[model samples]
Target chain A: MQAKLDKSDCMFLISDEKLNQFQQMIDELDLFTLVLPFVEESYQRSIWILDIWYSISNEEINRISNPENTMIYPYRNSILGIIKTLPIKRYIQLALYENERLAFLCAIYIYNELDDFISKKMAIKEEVKENFDALKKYSNKSLRPFFDSKYIEYENYPKKLAMLQNTVVNELHEIHKKYEIPLSWTFEKAIDDASKVYEAVFGLINDWGGRVP
Target chain B: MIISNQIEHLKNLYKDLKFLEVIQFGTITLPITLQEKRYDDALICYQYLASAYYENGSYENFHVVMTEYEKLCLTYGKDENKMYFYYLYSLLQVIVRDFDAAVEATKKSIKYAHFLKYHDLIVVNYYNIAAQLVHKKELEKARIGMSLAKFYKNNICESNITIVRGYIGALYYFATMGNNEEFQEVKQVFLKLIKDRQTFYDAKISFAEAILTLNLGQLEESVIFFEYAYLRFKEQQNIMFLINIEEYINNFNLGDKFQYTKELREIIKNSHRKPLDINNVKSVLSDLFEDDTSTLSIKYPNVISKELIVQHVEHALQNNETLYCFHWCFITDEIEELFGKLFVEQLLFTLFETVYHFIFKHNAEVNVLSKNEGEAFIRGISESEFFELLMELEEKLQSKVVHSKMGILEVPIHFGFIHSNQLPEKQASYEQLTAHADASLYYAKSHGQLYIYN
Candidate 1:
């Protein structure tokens, strides 16, 4: 009797080739796996990373749109939530994840580039900081600043640098959309993701670009 | 804390008594120029004006202002001032019964209040938040929030903190696992204030004293203090205090032989038929009479039986030896036989009855009124000498005939009565023993102008 060729097995076989191509694309773009290195093995750590990533950029988007309303309690609190969750430890770890090394390297490079770009435009930071301090004193009153400092920083970055940063933020947005997660929860999740990425990258690099001799 | 135009208006009103009166008289308008739109302006203005009016004793204007404020908040608004306005507006809503709206607005107000470091407002917001949580049966969270509110009030507030503290204590006392000690402790704090005479108003102090006495089962003492409080309130034109007293009196006046109680009940009933300020008392009486006693096994109703009533009268008679002459004299001969004189109770009853009859039957002449002078009169004398002096006075007042020359029934009729004056304030014995003498003396003096030291 002829062996029945299992259709499902054939489908899986076909998908393995596509998986290979997808991995190759991930390597080339360094984007698909950008968050992967940041994600810990544990479900909670992964979720935390997701939260951080989503809230930070979503807050940035809100600050960009209503720059006039940026320094108010709700707006400033949203930004502060992101600032508090920035994964200082995990940003250095993303390099060591087998599938996410490229994405890990790229996220840091993009984040640094954006920070550098904002620093270069000293005027915007000064103005934003002034308004932020004013808000501290008179918290009851709503504060509106003259310029969109967050957007100005975004626009001033080099095109490629900007694209990479935008891609990382978009990936967070996509993860949030896929998970049906709240923006705040997603930002919280992303802090863990970023910390994992930091650990992976540091681990990968500290091994002298290889395993311990 | 914001020191907005509302505060400015309040400052103006409080500048002088005339301005306060003027604020009451005219169409009181709040400074609404601060906000951009009329609706938002009115929304904020109404709260400030209402509070100002309330503080200034302009209740009519306060009501009007709150009504206007309610309308502005309910109207649709996307204005930036909506959240800010809602903070004050929601607090006002609680005073009215827009509880659902207050709950919603309170959450938003808390967020704003925290941002501003307005601790007082934050405390109020927390109170409302806790109240809402309680309504939803979120007791644990409500308790936590209430604790936080109390913490803030303790740290920041000065005068009105007692009110919030009392509220918390009451909530703990009734709704939670608070013991009698907890309730008694709060009560003692207030009681101490009353006992020390630190409380300014006599009526207020007496009312608190009455409550404390009642809680301690000093029911007769409580009634006397309540009467004092009731009279003081009436003299002061304080309708609210009068109502509170009437309510308490109605709860306790279930006894059989209390003649004053019947008089009081009739007066209160007549007052209620008119638009007297004692509507609360009327309602309280109606509720107590309508409800079954099983809910609270209070001692009052049972203590009103005929035998118990007679015992109370007897006890009152013993307290003041002279008051034995008023109502005790006329016990039926049958009662005297059944409760024989060989029994101490019967002997005391008979003595009281005999005194009562003796005082009423004849015009007993009481000529001299003199205070008890233990020190001034007997300081130089020895114990024996002091005894001789007392015997001399006793003989002179009781039997010796120091008559005039013409002798027209001129034996000086001076009763050697012990005066109740110059008594130490804290002596329980004085209170326990003196009332009967004073009452009898007072009755004697009123009836026949008899001179008795009391």
Candidate 2:
């Protein structure tokens, strides 16, 4: 059931080898195995991931086909689109199964890549910066740059990185309170961990001669 | 400490249904709780945010907030909060029309509540389950569920709000089953409970009073009660209850139905008139019943003919844009015939006007086609827009009031749609488009959907 549901709409966009490597990473991280005990819960997470992929692919396809219809900033669109897919129910399910957090992390990592690609392709840094400024009003000052270069320290061992991630999560909680952003501690932790995973993946790809495909 | 105080402030706003304010404050409240590493406080904020989003019809945001709430419950929340989470999840499912899932989730809530020995939570879950059963039309089972709710209310926690809600649920069940005596009994109890209380339950009491009077054949009094209820519901933004009142009004019957409806409309229009004159009410009964097309004319314009449909179809095909053909058919022909051909035509026209407004609100283009056949077409619509239109139409049709010779009639409408792209349009022609849409309409009618797409 997991495999059947794992057939993402965006799977065709990537090479088979790249897809295999992504799946291997997911397996190595023991994401699906952690969710194995809860059938309905796991299935819901799978559906959510598929939905996110479907949306991202649709946006990508639309952008490619009709460049004139680009109304929203690509980076903002990708971030908001991915966030939209992770509603409260899925968040809880992922939180319940610790391993499932990896799946969320993987999704964010992929989206970060897409965001980068769109930003470079369209040369919309000024527009992207303006959009980020708008988003900053809703977020805290400390956690404003939610994704940053500090997370790309792949040379730091996983356990050390995990400790660093924990600190970021703790900081985010304070930021949330200071800013009065309506978010759960669990959600804050999940998002922080996802950012860590995203940075790690980017660091890994960089180490592998930056051959993302 | 300050965060809790802030939460209390937002809680007051939430109770007042000041959703926008609550949401604005929540942005700060949620982050503060999280930043302080107060998972429990964060959970509470999520609950408030979720409810606000749900009430405001921002399902996507609600889903996001609820997910966070659920996560917190699993991670750090106590059993009571977990039970509350399930209860909220069930309510959200019901709003989205997932009845089976709602029932399952409610059962989970009840289980958790029972484990925690929280009688109030258990009773609330049972009440919700009963409400879902009522929507399912399983009245007997709903009655049993309501009985359980009442039993729990009596035994453990007999709060005024709980008792009022219990009575309201009973009233709804009895009214739906056409048990007028039982309905009146429940209404009396409900009214007595709110007789002297300076509470927000006045709107609910007035609603119960409206139903009771309507059942007792006191049409004028019922109309007044209904108007009062509508005003209160609108102010509170209690859309669900408002929809219920609209449904009840749709089935209203007076001796001279047409004249009474006209007078009711006039009274509603006269917003400045407070403590309405009894003479105006009496004049409604004596006034000559004129079939006025004025209201209908103002609401609906540019009624399309069959020839016009062909032109629209040609234009859609030429532009390579998607055309959404919607077919609406009344369930009861007898009711239509009783209302007279002209009156029925006017009603259909008004329905078209409502649909047009609804479509345009979603930024979709709509054109009324073949007014006599109750057909219309929309173009350049997305799936989400189509679904939103269906929801709006369902609410409209359920609540729309029309007077007929045989008392009052709530004509059940069958709606179906087909996309132009779905048609076998080797050559884009009206014959092919209509034929395909007609078939989809037939399927939707048989399948009992507001609208089915092909």
Candidate 3:
């Protein structure tokens, strides 16, 4: 709300009568916004706990790919079912019902949580195994310096960038390859995409505007 | 003063929580104790050796050790020896996960203690049975056993550390059994007994507390207790038990616990424990536990002020952190009317001491709040974790009953909590957080819920 107050355009407060109505809306909204902090963290954790279900790195990929781990598919699929169907739609409905823009942070938190579990087997540059291990150890955001260093060689392997472009431009079957290892996208790119989901839940406000009253 | 260096070395290693080291060093001393016919010393050595075998997961070697221990029991068994034998056997039975056998052994030990007129051991045995019965989920039998434990509580010899240790743990089982009257009686003795004596991290007691709380659907409380047990096991460096705690967290799906149990996860990732090669160790001794032993003798709080809790809230806001501040209010005005004001003071004192003692053992940083109101400030947690931990602490505290000389008074606890994350300002917002907690407490007090989180 402070962000909205400080950062709003003069057009949003064009008239004295409009400004008074905005104040009235905020007074009513504070009653519901007071409960969103609780909603935000619960949804945030509900998202993070899905980390164990994701098979990200090659080692994790291999571990889950093992025949012995086949039984865990049903459980993982159940979680995926919830992620794919329930939350995104439900949180949108919630924001609409509450008539509050901040309530949509719950949806974004859930989106970011499910985004981390998006995994596919990709062959990266074979030489950067050490860099792969380091990336596994730390975040791509923090490891940006390592990638940009003088001796690094991440020319063309990750495939995620091309995958994203293909996703935008092509049909569903045309986007994914059957089995061609590429050097176009790096693990760095993949993690960066996930980490780009700003932690808006903890410090959420209604600056983005509410529903039409 | 004339203790054998070998026996002294073994005992020292045992006391240091180095059970595996004790097993390695004790291979030589067990034969020496047997050759000398030091029955008392041999019995004590067997107790130490069995404990090591238990912790080391050398159960096959433990079976041989028990066989040898029984021979010595039969040969030199008098009332004192027999009582001690059954007691040790019962303890070892628990190590083997045989609850029924342990209860039967405890009953036999009780009989011998009865014959020998060893009142402290009798109380110890009864409470031991109560503990075992509770573990078996035979709560009705456990309640009866708890009553017998109380009947002999007056005879607990403080000098006998074993008896003192045994009786001090009785306070939790009544809480576990939900026997309010028995819980009240034991609560009094528990507070008075532990007041002067110090406490060590008993992993066994911590395990029981963790499991009992978990069974009560108090997952947050269980994780906190399990965390304490994990720390205790860390001090012992028992890789297997530490891993077991990790499994329990994963299995129970406790408290968004993957990150919460990160240390255990690290241990599981890094350490690989091989089962103890008892055959190799026993080959050195020529027999696993050719025991000679001696009788054993054993020897062995911070509170949060309200102002400090508010200050921590302010500090957290300044630093962009969160603090879960609990204002635990005791609804004792009715108690003051029913009993006198003086009796309520003692009940509050018990509450204060128990809370303080718990805080001290966990090394939680805080001061003693005033008698009537208590506070716990858990720093930097997510809201979900706060609710889990709040439910746990509230149940544990609300179940607290005091047995004053006037009568048993179950103090009604109302826990109100607030976090700094919800506040608007960094500078003067501490008052808002605390007043929110105060209002939460007032709501809980009036509404009669266990807690209200603001």
Model 3 whole-model lDDT (C-alpha atoms): 0.49
True-structure lDDT of candidate 2: 0.53
User: Best-fitting candidate, measured by lDDT?
Assistant: 2
Residue-level lDDT of model 3, residues B169-265, one tens digit each, is: 4645754664446545654555455454333335645765676677677777777778888887777665656766776787888738534477677
* Candidate 2 lDDT, A80-194, residue by residue in tens: 3434444433432333233333444544344333333333433344554443333323211112111222223322222322334443334333433443333333345544445
Q: Per the 3 Å backbone cut-off, how many clashing residue pairs does candidate 3 have? A: 17
Compared with the true structure, all predictions reach lDDT values of 0.38, 0.53, 0.49
Identify the runs in model 2 with alpha carbons over 4 angstroms from their true place. Answer: A1-213, B4-28, B48-78, B157-167, B178-200, B208-222, B237-241, B247-454
What local lDDT score does residue B250 receive in model 2, on the 0 to 100 scale?
64
Evaluate every candidate with DockQ and list the scores.
Answer: 0.00, 0.01, 0.01
Candidate 2 lDDT, tens digit per residue, B320-410? 8777767676665665667677777767766666766675564343333244335566777886887777888888866777764556667
Q: Which stretches of candidate 1 lie over 4 Å from their true place?
A: A1-213, B1-44, B52-63, B70-84, B87-98, B151-454
Which has the better TM-score: candidate 1, or candidate 2? 2
User: Candidate 1's residue-wise lDDT over B1-454, tens digit each?
Assistant: 2334544554444332233343443233344333435554454455445544543333345556555554454443332234444554554444444566665566555544544545656566665566555655556555655655555566574533223312332333222322346445545554543353222244554666676566667778777777787676655544444555666676765233223455555555665433322211111111121122211212223212222333443443346422211111112233334444344343333333333233323322111101110001111224354345434543433342223344523222222122222323222122222223333332333333232323
Error of 1 at B333 (Å): 99
Candidate 2 local lDDT, residue B323: 71
Runs in model 3 deviating more than 4 A are A1-213, B1-31, B39-41, B48-67, B155-159, B167-172, B178-205, B212-218, B239-251, B258-454
